[model samples]
Target chain A: MSEASKSARPDGSNRPAVQLRSAVALLGSFPALAGVDLDVHHNDVALLQGPNGAGKTTLLRLCAGLIGPSSGTAMVLGQDVGSANGRRRVRRSVGLMGHSTALYDDLTVEQNVQFWAAASKAESETVVPALDRTGLAGRLQTVKVSALSAGQRRRTALAVLLCRRPSLWLLDEPHAGLDKDGRELVNGLVLEAKDAGATILIASHDLDWATSVATRRIDVVGGRVVEGTVVEDAVVKGTVVKDADA
Target chain B: MLSDARLIAAKDLRIEASSRVLLTQVLPFGLMVLLLFGFGISPDRQVLGEVPRRSVLEQVSPGLFWITVLFAALLGLGRSFSIEAADGNLDGLRLGGLDPAGIFLGKAAAVIVQLAVLEVIVGVGAILLFGVSLANVGLLAVTIVGATVAIGCAGTLYATLAAGQRVRETLVPLLVLPVLAPVLLGATQATEAALFGPVSDGWPWAGLLGAFALLYIAIGIVAFGSFLEES
Candidate 1:
């Protein structure tokens, strides 16, 4: 295992990593997330499968403490996502890779990764390894993000996420712009993170790949989680076991 | 919090260095405005009942210089947030767990530096073109520092408020200029006293500018997180 996989593991306790009960989030006057109920345990690689405007991104943002729930309760890493101080505390432990890469175009790949790591208060040593892991160590590291291709930008964003090593990883469309090799790199990183005891919630249209890596599958529809759609993945046996409620 | 502020400030400055938008675009724009004003109010032309167009231009040069700086600061402020709006960098900053107050201070600090540079270049242009002489260099420096800090804090605060909006480019001026009216007036007055005469009269205006800067700084520190969350 690489040193990047040596981050602090989840505690042995059974406390859920994410718990939401009728959590509602609004985008302006419209309810982007109507009401969601979910519970994700530590080390679970959960995939949030949803159609366009189905609120998958909103749910991820809520868990990341970027937005507060308008109604109901949301708890991530033992902090309420609705309170300012709680959200701040939750943010310290969550890593979110949204649709946007969140990169500074004028900054070199190395500078962007280092800035994020430093901002997250992660150790400075983690930066070089993250770049290497994301295949951004050589000449790519010196290139400004604006000069890079779409796949390269995605890799740079991934390097940033790796450097932080947050307890919960929220990735939206993680494989959108990647090539075949790049897609495999993402899957491998997801597995490595899961094995290191990090809980992941990914929203991806690439169903086959996401399902292959996810331990549990969730379907979100109409701004809410489809009841009883949660299923346990038997990737080892290449089958899915539906819940009794389904 | 201070450490985070330093980090964010350094990051912003690095972005500016690489892009050079402020230097190549905004600085030149300010100088052009000064030159245009100089041309419009030719020193040879007389007006205001034989007050001598030269004297008239010199008297109003302080106001013209501050106005030019304000306009340039608007462009600087817009550029500052436009980078964050791009690629959703503001969201990334929020999730980085750095103190919101620190981010506000860092951004405001970067704007202050940029605006200060704009003031220096435009100040020299105004002095040479408008034929104005500085009577009190100390008071002028104090006024520039206070006014620049005030504009930076207020501009940054408003910029974040308008960030991520589709109309951010248009909305920032609408939101900030009205709020910064007092700054425009106070800076112009203090600058006038600094360049022409009566240095004692400028101190009160400079004091007001300083007070406004401190007020906005406190507001930004306390309220920045909320604004950031909304954006």
Candidate 2:
């Protein structure tokens, strides 16, 4: 798994974990990611902050190979993410945690994690320790996800992420719906994964919470990454992008 | 690839077992459809004893059986994707590294399992309630397998096409039913020939059904990735 994560270019140098060159993606004729250019290296913890509809989620989805760039190139782990073979290979080594927990309402927590773990080609035995790491050890294997609280549900999703051990973690709002303890678990997990050499890209509105763990931070607004700070402008609903030089 | 397909199919089947939605709801609805057709066709036989009830039922049983199976199978197809859409489990599956072709095959296979069980119960009920008998049971088997495969593959493919859309519920039937007209015609005619004798046209109908099934399976394998990404 570690060897697979070190995806090398033709010249044998390891490629940037994610690289987007003037990439454009459309959602219903509207550009979601409009001419975006960015790069993140291996083990880099890059944080993305923006107002709603600023293309944060779209960028993450693009990196996850869930959406293709309408124009330009979006590469992840040396693969052109727009291609089918590239997307399939990228999916094998990347994990994306989005708004949804993605857990089955009827399946038990253990079963949910086990299913993902196996799908990610991890050993089934990793499920137990993953659950333990996420502080869901008390929940019985028979307990359904629908029966769990919001925090517990988040923890279960975290457990699946831990077990999969993806090379790249694309997380959108990791702290959403989590309590203080749950947030701390997320913080520790991110740092831990980075220490183990996994690249991380996180998109979140809560700048203060994410700032502490982020190695690099960028602001996005109006579907493009701006060299700016996010200001609370009531007119734009908290999406005022003020240039850094301003 | 087959292993991935088997894993996905197993997971889907486990979820179905836990919910019991197909068994408790869909199966009963199919039987009710059969019963309703029985009443609708044989209305007050004492008043109108012009045509024999047994002969009329026998004549209509092939169409009724296929219709009931199609309607009941719709329930499973809709629910199959609805469960995934509930919390974005579909995204999880996509990111889980399973090949898109494998996912399609696995989902279609699970639907086949469900429809096969539904067909057995409904077929038996049709035989008894409609007083229909089989002449060439072998041809009947061929028709069932080919038709069920056709429906399952087409259903899974079309269901994913509308997986996350607002009008997915209405859109699925519209997309799937029209495409499935050939399967219905072939299966119904094949069953008719199988039941009444000669087995002449039944073979050709079964062949057509098999061809449609293979075509769908191939299309699903090659096309699911693009369709899934769009959805």
Question: Over the full model, what C-alpha lDDT does candidate 1 score relative to the true structure?
Answer: 0.87
Q: Which portions of model 2 show Cα errors greater than 4 Å?
A: A1-15, A228-246, B43-53
Of candidate 1 chain A, the 10-residue stretch with the lowest lDDT total is A237-246
Off by over 4 Å in 1: A1-12, A227-246, B46-54
lDDT for B209 in candidate 1 is 91
**Location of the lowest summed lDDT over 10 successive residues in candidate 2 chain B:** B43-52
Model 2 clash pairs?
Answer: none
Give a tens-digit lDDT track for model 2, residues A106-224: 88988898888988889988898888778777645569888988878888998999998988898899988888777777877887787677888889987766766776677888888
Identify the candidate with maximal DockQ.
1
Deviation of model 1 at A112, angstroms: 0.1
Candidate 1, residue A142: the lDDT equals: 99
Q: What number of clashing residue pairs does each candidate have, in the order they appear?
A: 0, 0
Cα deviation of B211, candidate 1, in Å: 1.5
